[model samples]
Target: MPMAADDIETLIRTAIPDAQITITDLAGDGDHYAAHVVAESFRGLPRVRQHQAVYAALGGRMGGVLHALQLTTAVPKE
Candidate 1:
């Protein structure tokens, strides 16, 4: 089964409690998604690491239940 938007948000929030997340279904099919995540914890992280954190939050669902995800991460603006 494809992952739900709420599930994705919940998982990320679980890992990064202060994340501001926005999820979009790019294909109109639950399988493909785009996530924009902003968090204080990402302040000094590299882009690759930021994305990795989000991936980790999903618990290895990428390329399995959740096929494609276009992810963008940023630190919250002051």
Candidate 2:
């Protein structure tokens, strides 16, 4: 099954409550998405780790229910 944009945002917010997230449907299909997430929790974490954290929030839905995701993660500006 494809994942909804709101569903994606909800999952991320659940894991990182303080997250400022922007989710976009890349193909007009629920299967493809792009998310830009910013949170204080990502501070000091490496870029790869930041992306990992977002993936973890999805609970292994990446390649299954949810197909492609172009993700960008960042810490809030100080």
Candidate 3:
């Protein structure tokens, strides 16, 4: 089954409690999504590492239930 947007947000928030997350259903199928995440914790991390953090939050559901995720990460503007 495809994952729910709320579930995705919850999982990410669980991993990064301070994250500001915006999830959009890209294809309207519930499988493809775009996530824009901003967090103070992302500061100084490389882009790949930031993406890894969000993927880790998903707990191995990336290629299975979650499918494609178009992710963008940014450190909060100070």
Candidate 4:
């Protein structure tokens, strides 16, 4: 089954309530997506750690049902 964009957004929002997220369907399939996320929670985190947090929000579905996720995480601009 393919993952929904809204669902992905919701998951991230649930994990980081103040996040601003943009989810794009990379392959025109729900399994492949690119997410650009800005959140207060990512504020001092390393790039890898920030990415990890986003992936963890998906409940380990990265290589399973979710497939590919090109993720970019940033702290909210001052």
Candidate 5:
């Protein structure tokens, strides 16, 4: 079964408590998603590391319950 968008957001929120997350279903199917996350903790991190953190927040579901995720991360605007 495909994962719900709310589940994805909840997982990220659990890990990165201060994250500002926006999830969009690129396709009508729930398996493909795009996530844009903003967080204060990502301020000094590299882009790769920031993305990794968001992926990690989803636990090990990347290839199983969740099919594909296009992720973008950034620190909050000043």
Candidate 6:
């Protein structure tokens, strides 16, 4: 079974309470997804680190219950 968009969003929110997340199914399957997230936690983090934070939010779900995630993270506009 693949992950649900709501699950992805929930995971992100669980980690970053103020996160704004948008999830799209890249392959029309739940296994492949693209996530665009904006959070205050990313304010000073590098792009790689920001992504890492989001991945961590998923609790290592990448490549297992969740197959692939194309992630984009940003801090909220000032």
RMSD vs true structure, all candidates: 0.6, 0.7, 0.5, 0.8, 0.6, 0.8
Candidate 3 worst ten-residue window by lDDT = 69-78
Residue 71: error of model 4 in Å? 0.4
lDDT (Cα atoms) of all candidates against the true structure: 0.96, 0.95, 0.97, 0.91, 0.95, 0.92
Tens digits of per-residue lDDT for model 2, 1-78:
788999999999999999999999999989999999999999989999999999999999999999999999988887
Clashing pairs in 3: none
| Window of ten residues with lowest summed lDDT in model 2 | 69-78
lDDT of candidate 6 over 4-70, digit per residue (tens): 9999999999998989999999999899999999998789889999888888999988989999998
Across residues 1-46, which tens digit of lDDT does each residue of candidate 3 receive? 9999999999999999999999999999999999999999999999
**lDDT (C-alpha) at residue 6 in model 5:** 98
- Pull out the clashing pairs in model 5: none
Ranking by lDDT: 3, 1, 2, 5, 6, 4
lDDT of 1: 0.96
**Which candidate has the highest lDDT of all?**
3
Residue 53 lDDT in candidate 1: 95
Name model 3 segments beyond 4 Å from true.
none
lDDT of 4 by residue, 11-76 (tens): 988988888999999999789999999988888889999898888899988898899998999998
Itemize residue pairs with steric clashes in candidate 2.
none
> lDDT value for candidate 6?
0.92
Clash count, predicted structure 3: 0
Give TM per candidate. Answer: 0.97, 0.96, 0.97, 0.94, 0.97, 0.94
Clash count, candidate 4: 0
Model 3 residue 54 lDDT? 99
